[model samples]
Target: MTTKSITIKSDRTIKSIMPPTKGEILCKVSGHPKLFLRVNASGAKLWLYRYTHPVMKSKHKLSLGSYPAVTLAHATAMRLEYEQLLQQGIDPKAHREQQIKDEHKSLASTFEKVAWHHFEQLKNKQKATTLKRKHGRYELLCSYLGDTPIGDIEPLQMLEVLRDIQANSLKDDGTPTDKADRCAVIASDIFNHAIVHGYATNDPARIVKPMLDSYRYGNRPSITTPSEFGQLMRDVETLKGTVHDSVFHSIKLLSLLFIRNGDLRRLRWSDVNLDMAQIDLQPMKGHGASKLRMVKDMIVPLSRQAVEILKAQQAITGHTDYVFHSDTATKNNIINENAANDALKSLGYQGTHCAHGFRASARTMLRHKLKYDKDVIEMALGHITRDPNGTAYDRWEFVEERSQMMQEWSDYIDNLKTGKTDNVIKMPRMRQNDIKTV
Candidate 1:
């Protein structure tokens, strides 16, 4: 009996047999030595063929590929070509795999893609700042090395970033932390995550170590001496208005608050009790927890100067709840951490001060000049210092004292802004407690 050829569309319907099912058709394609048609559940059909290596007698199969894409005529032609190759002792499958590998060679995989995917997989599994930090690293990686394929990134490329960060070495400030060893670990984690998902062949980051005894850490901008700090404050006082005076007195006041620039930027009227003259700082994520016992419900008795600055800021940007808003009607927060630094730089106060430097400036002045106890000053600045008594105690025990401390602190900062004498202001008596205690 002659075997009937399978029609591309005909289902063996005329006889008692039902239309050929997908499994039957698929099996036929896999088993056929010459030619066969397979139909899928979606009614899609394609042609496939089977061949034996003439030299090795090894059986193998070849797909003519998808229909319409591989026209019947082209498939027939390809089948004849494969037979010719088999006759010539060439393995068709090996050639196709090689072609596949070559087609992907010119493409480069980026760390950014891996970083983004890493974050996506880790979302809500960690702190929000982790997301933000990873995102920033993603941008830098993309900007700097996104064009490189995942498998091609080398240890040298990563070490160079580390060296650049250690150099503070970038602008005058040296290598930013993005190039730090810790940051390198994060970069490795991103590549490792890709390896987990099969996107990366290996993590180049793993070649770098946790800590190198001799490798210089990232360049950290430090105050180092009180005199240089004083020079910085004196220089800051000279900052004047730009075009619309985008740099205002409030931004200067914010520099003294010295919380994360973003937290200060988002400071809202709801977060502040002006009648009580206190700023209620909600503990921001990523910055270590505020250790002041006064925090949570802590009342930052606004200094006369801080209050004045707030009031002045209120009058101008009252349209929103933020005391110091940006020009773009964004939230009341200051947009640029760089704004304070830039303002300082424009005034010839180069690397000596950063917005964060204000915290150091205040802490140092409180210690040396105002004579506020270390804990009180640290608490006021949202820092938690170990109690010398060897136990965790209220860092800001004297609210009245702290209120006085903060007031003095504010006045001193205002003095610096106004070009007043360079003398460090004295802190007021640490208040024991006046009110707002539960």
Candidate 2:
């Protein structure tokens, strides 16, 4: 006989048996949905369930996992939920697991993860410092909006963040404050990354514009000219007792060779061909050991001055593969990230120039002053070739051509500093051949 409510004596022990016998089949529970109580034949205390399946015609047995683990209130709610599912003809177990899976799917697509995924895609395509800066942006996003799920960063919240940045950051024209228009571009990219990877439905940043009613005041500064750039290099040469001298020289070499500073500073001696004045750029940054890390190698030809600098550095440094190094205790180790900038400041030319300002200088000098082919400059810089049809073309960085370029460059710097620079040289069309005497 089955009854909904019954109680075992407080002193008596109860047991559930595979086959019932009169002496052993006692009142199984203490009749309270709030508390489940039973005892097995070995006198083990157990919890029992007395409920009907919401979706099945037959009553099935399920262990409520384990005792103490399945607390009374939790068990009661679970039982009631199953009963409701049964009433609705839904499989409660399958449905619950599916619900958990769905919840996980929602949480997996956070803004931080998606933005990082975008950064990961572009990591190798960019320079090392560029990668570091992008990673920095990701860190900022994590700090400010990381906890907010990807789908939840509405346009208004993004707008607020942009406005706040403008309010506190320094402004041009001596204004009290201004929003970071450049940072707004960064935010747009983060949202774009989310959209590209399906982490977000739309780029919220794209929806908002950083204009004071259509007067788009983007604040990217104009770069220094190659002539002005020459003086900076002279200053770098004259810079005394600065820790950054080594980094500054390396940065100068990068501008002359037109290479990424990250790639240039991280070079090893084994990659250089002093005999041929060439550098067999590895398929990745730092070559040998770091290629396995998925960085692509690029070959760059060393200029005459570049080779001279290396030889000078080697005279003092002794036998080592690193072309650029520091006075740190670690053997075979190079300078840290801040070494170049520190050197720049110590040389008394801070704020007026940058290690990367060389890129702007080179791009302009090659394009206007020397009037070399754009593709040639790009190739020299180890930038991605514009020739879409070209296979991984390994052009031996034409040493003779670069040698002429280097001599003229060095001479131009000397002339600029001595106040003998020609007025006509500033004209955009001035060619390399036109300046016969340096």
Give candidate 2's whole-model lDDT. 0.57
The estimated TM-scores of all candidates read: 0.57, 0.52
**For each candidate, what is the lDDT?**
0.59, 0.57
> lDDT score, residue 239, model 2?
54
Residues 242-287, model 1: lDDT tens digits = 6224455644675556555555666777777778887877645432
Worst 10 residues of 1 by lDDT: 9-18
